[model samples]
Target: MRPLEGHHAIVTGGGSGIGAAIARTLAAQGARLTLVGRRAAPIEALAHALHGTAVTADVTDRAQVDAALAHARAANGPVTILINNAGAAESTPFARIDAAGWRRMMAINLDAVFHCTQAALPDLRAASAGRIVTVASTAALKGYAYTAAYAAAKHGVLGLTRSLALELAGTSVTVNAVCPGFTDTAIVAEAAANIARISGRTPDAARAELARFNPQGRLITPEEVAASVLWLCLPDSGSITGQAIAIAGGEVM
Candidate 1:
């Protein structure tokens, strides 16, 4: 039998990027999925393609997250695997980082993870053996030059993951974080655009410059991050709790 046969999983931000990749990979591995995202179109499209359930909700809102979790549980059974992949990122000089921007990043990146994982506990406990994975960033382990707020929020995610892993230590549950560096996702496009506007380089040049941080001289792919996530959910990964596995192509060290 497939490793994840009959398992139920919930993937937030499953509409696109790393989240989409994770949802697809898990489904292929025999995990039934419930995909959650703010937008309906992409999530629905992905659900149709992957034969998963889709729920559109703004993860930053607690009530919305609760509703989404309920919908997911109804469709896919108790969430034996929770992928807290919904997040936002922004980069700005430390001196220019405004409170509003800071809070927005925190709400989507840190607060959303808190709310989603808390809301999923009942279902996770029902499963008895569950996996909770958060998509953090290399910035969480290290620091980023112009991404102070984003880095802080990701760091908060890792802290939360470690704490939850300890809290549920005796139980048949695992909590971990996946920290990716310069991945080829829409976030990279946004960053490239922002950098191009600020530094007067073409967006293509900005992307290349960012990719230089990865020792491989290339950007990490969403599929690669998804694969690492799948590995953490395997039966053999029961002992790998409270870990922050970096998918940064050796950039964080």
Candidate 2:
């Protein structure tokens, strides 16, 4: 039998990149998957491929999240694992970030986490092995240039992970965050574009510049991040809670 044979896993941002990778990994281990994303086409296609259910909803909105989760639970069972992987990052100079920019970052990166965790808390608390793994970034651990708003929001989510872990310590729930650095995702492409615009460098050059942060001279893969997330949801990892597991190649350490 698969390790996650009886688990019900809900993955937000599950249409692509790390979220999709995590969903695939969990489904492989026998967990029922509910792919949640803002885009219907992508999530629906991926869900079809993986034989999972797709529910399109902007996680930053509470009403959308609640309705989405209800649909998910009705399709699958209650959530035993919740992956908070839906987020966005805007790279702008501190002085250029207006109130709208800062609020947008917080709403997507931090507030969405709060809403999802609360919405899934009941089922997670009742599950025999409840796991919540958030896909945070290394920016949460350290500061990033021209990404003050993004970093601040990431740090807030990491703080939430820690606090919620403690609050749920008495229960069967475990909350953790995975911090990935310079991942090879569309977000990284956006960052590279920002760098190219600022430094007047080629996009490839900007990507190389971003990859230099890793001593390995390469960006982390979504599958690498997904593997760690999958491990955290395994039954053996029940004791590993309230931790920020960095998937950076020595960039964080």
Candidate 3:
């Protein structure tokens, strides 16, 4: 609808799955984009296909994130919309969760959000109006049996979301988070694999286990999450800040 016409957007982890969907959806709404990811291949491919810019950087690295955002601002415009969609999750038993795992999870999921949001705050403030959407998971709102670390990190993301919303209260910038349940993405596939290995069940069975968590008996699609994000970026959505809308087919309820 060109609601975002003349705007520039930065989507972390825009290489595939929900991130890619968000990138394409924003592009469709007439926003020029800068896609960021650790790997260059997918971002390059997406940038080429969608006529967007691409940057390869690990979001956890403050220097790298600053460089990427600088490149994005130089190539496009001040980032008016930012989607903190880059995250990683691994199912580990509470007792077996190693220090490295915990640090890595927090680095990519929590620290990355902090770094990128801080890096983009000046531009967003300069714009006088901006949107910051973080793609958290339903785990942020509830505890999962074997996903303590992941859930904790996502909870941190939501905390940032709400706190930023309050901090920017009365400002034109709106901050919100979308919590999706059992989304059909590589993250789910990794979860399925872990479940299979741990529980000695077939991958199909583990996958089904996650699907059953959704009342619809199906995984939510990336496009669906993207649509929700697009909604938040609309001019009329300024009043939606500090909300964590769940796309879980009634599962969260």
Candidate 4:
């Protein structure tokens, strides 16, 4: 059965990778979608194909997020499921990261989750199957070199997820995080490129180095992460909350 049929769902970063995969998965489950992204082309294309609405907004900006969701609601009704999937990564030594860069990381990876979750909480609380799933990174659970800022923000994401989950434990809303490791996505591709550039390694070798982080010796798939998010949104997963489920192929226990 299409468990989410008619449910209003908002998926940020719905343009590609994990976000797009989640959007498609939720759409297939019969959820009405609001595809949120900074770019217009990709999300619009995906939304068109999925028969969903597409809204553009800088998710890191609270006012923009609010305005964008206002439009999304007009198109798809109140949001019941919020997927905080919009995020970026930067690889830099801790000493090299400036204040601006650190703040940018926090804004995109941490504060943006705050804005979107806050904007959708009321509707989620009202829905019979409210779900808030944030696409965090395995970095949240563990540490990595040249990624202090990114790791810090992601770790903050888990803290937010758990704290919110506790505060809303008695409600219908469930807050959780999916932490992926070296996912086969544009973000990973960028990381590979950065590694290649810095270490003068071949792109293939750099990617392989990342894959080696996982005990499974392969990169995680976007669909794999999406599947976990879909499961959490299901009615049967109601009892699960305040949890950070790792999709890192044992990269993080």
What TM-score, over all chains together, does every model reach? 0.97, 0.98, 0.97, 0.98
User: Candidate 1: global Cα-lDDT?
Assistant: 0.92
| Residue 79 local lDDT, model 2 | 94
Query: Candidate 4, residues 1-253: lDDT per residue as tens digits?
Result: 6999879999999999999999999999999999999999999999999999999899999999999889999999999999999999998999999999999999999999999999888899999989999999999998999999999999999999999999999999999999998899998899899889989999999999999999999999999999999999998999999999999887755
Whole-model lDDT values for every prediction? 0.92, 0.94, 0.93, 0.94
* Lowest summed lDDT window (length 10), candidate 2: 244-253
**Lowest summed lDDT window (length 10), candidate 4:** 244-253
- The alpha-carbon deviation from the true structure for residue 128 of candidate 2, after best TM-score superposition, in angstroms, is 0.3
Give the clashing pairs for model 1.
Answer: none
Off by over 4 Å in 2: none
Deviation of model 1 at 120, angstroms: 0.5
Clashing pairs in 4: none
Model 2: lDDT of residue 164:
91
lDDT of 3 by residue, 1-253 (tens): 5789988999999999999999999999999999999999999999999899999999999999999999999999899999999998887789999999999889998999999999999888777569999999998899898788899999999999999999998789999999999999998998899889989999999999999999999999999999999999987898999999899999954
| Residues 1-253 of candidate 1: C-alpha lDDT, one tens digit per residue | 8899988989999989999999999999999999998899999999999999999999999999999888887887788999999988887889999999999999999999999999988777667569999999998899879889999999999999999999998888899999999999999999999989999999999999999999889999999999999999886788999999999887855
Question: In candidate 1, residue 46 scores what lDDT?
Answer: 97
* Better TM-score candidate (3, 4): 4
Error of 1 at 19 (Å): 0.6
